[model samples]
Target: MKGTIHKCLAALVKEEYGEDAWKKCLQSSGFEPERNFALTEDIEEENSINLIVESAKVLDIPLKKLFDQFGVYWCCTYAPKHYSFWYVGMKDAKAFIIKLDEIHGLVGKHFNNAKPPRFLYHWTDKNQKVLKVEYQSNRKLIDLYISLVNGLAIYFKEEIEINKISEHEVELTFDY
Candidate 1:
């Protein structure tokens, strides 16, 4: 996991739930109340999971709800503001999704011990409206991935019908 993720999660919690809640969440997760994660720093996977679980617990929300909210905040607000270069020529959700794997690869190059998820895509329909995306990651954060896709739809102001094909696959039908 990357510290950037932790940083974004912290920001989301502080902005939406207030600083006190964020501090409590961090303390409950076995972290110092004032701990800060550097954007490019490496974070332990277990610690990241613990932080997420504790955040949900502290906020009195379901884990999936937290994931959903974080995904939207990361995709639409945090990433765009912090990594504007990544969105240089992105026109829509489809364009961004198609380039996600490549973008991750580029991101990995800048960080030590980075192991971002890999995405493989195939068009299911002749007209290319439906896309089947295969997600590969040791972390198994499929719910978060699905939420991020939903966030992409919201970010682009596009209607996307998403179907979970399996634990590691999804079918996205785009309305264009």
Candidate 2:
């Protein structure tokens, strides 16, 4: 799975960088600002994979974890092979991620590890829910979320569809 490590990219310049700095660097790097996160014109060659792998290394984000977090497929102008970059939303995923980590310190601890379990403990409208996800080694967190919702549908005996996925999380609605 291919994904960009924004923190690593931000660290490419300075220490103690804030949100604006991150956006600036990404923008300067030719990354287009999507609604939530930024998107860069990806080049689809072997080098793309190399870049993602190297970024993961620089960020100290375990390769396995990187794969787990953003292994989704994407199309880039440079490469037609259908490669991957970090899948973020219209919002800054990092900020909410930091908050999630704060709320569930365990998430950060496990996320930093390569072999962390595929489980997300979060609040659904103030109610706690446990999500057991599959080994989406190369998919976006949103994709994983969609898959989780699919699974939950079966568990709850209801039908649902995912409307949007933000950097913080995904939005889902059920139709009766």
Candidate 3:
């Protein structure tokens, strides 16, 4: 996982829960108590999982909600605010959505250690504005992916209908 993901989640926990809760989450997640994660650095997957678990325990919320909400925050707020350069030409949600693989490819080029997820877009129903998204990741984060898609739709203020086709795939329907 990338440090930027962890950093934004940490920020969410701190901003919503409290600074101490975030500190505790970091400590329990096997990261340094006051460590500042670099944006391009690679975070250990195990540590990132630990942080999610610890954050759930501290915030008294289910891990699913945490993951989903973090996904929402990532695309809507954090990425827009801190990583605006990445979205330079990809202003709208659909533009960014379709180019996710390209974006990840670029990130991989700039940061050798980055391991981003693979996104494959398939237009299932061209007339009805239905599209199938294939999210392939070692991490079982279908919920996060769903929320992330919804967040992106919301960012563009698009009314979308999403259906989970499988554990690793989803279908999005909307007006183009």
The most accurate candidate by TM-score is 1
TM-score each candidate: 0.97, 0.25, 0.90
- Lowest summed lDDT over 10 consecutive residues: which window, candidate 1? 105-114
Cα lDDT of model 3 by residue, 29-135, tens digit: 67787988778787788887778888888788988788777877887799889977876776566677788888877887888777777888888774747788888
Give me the displacement of residue 5 in model 2, in angstroms. Answer: 20
Candidate 1: tens digits of C-alpha lDDT, residues 10-84 = 999999999999999999999999999999898888999899998999999999999999989999999999988
Minimum summed lDDT over a 10-residue window in model 2 is located at 71-80
Candidate 2: where are CA atoms >4 Å away? 1-107, 110-139, 165-169
What ordering of candidates by TM-score runs from best to worst?
1, 3, 2
lDDT tens readout by residue for model 2, 1-176: 11223323333323433455545544544454331322232243444445445545545567555443332211111111322122233133222222332322453353433222243434344332222222222324444345434433443355555554443345444443
lDDT of each: 0.92, 0.37, 0.81
Model 1 lDDT, residue 70, Cα:
93
Candidate 1: deviation at residue 5, Å? 0.3
Screening candidate 3 with a backbone cut-off below 3 angstroms (N, C-alpha, C), the clashing residue pairs are: none
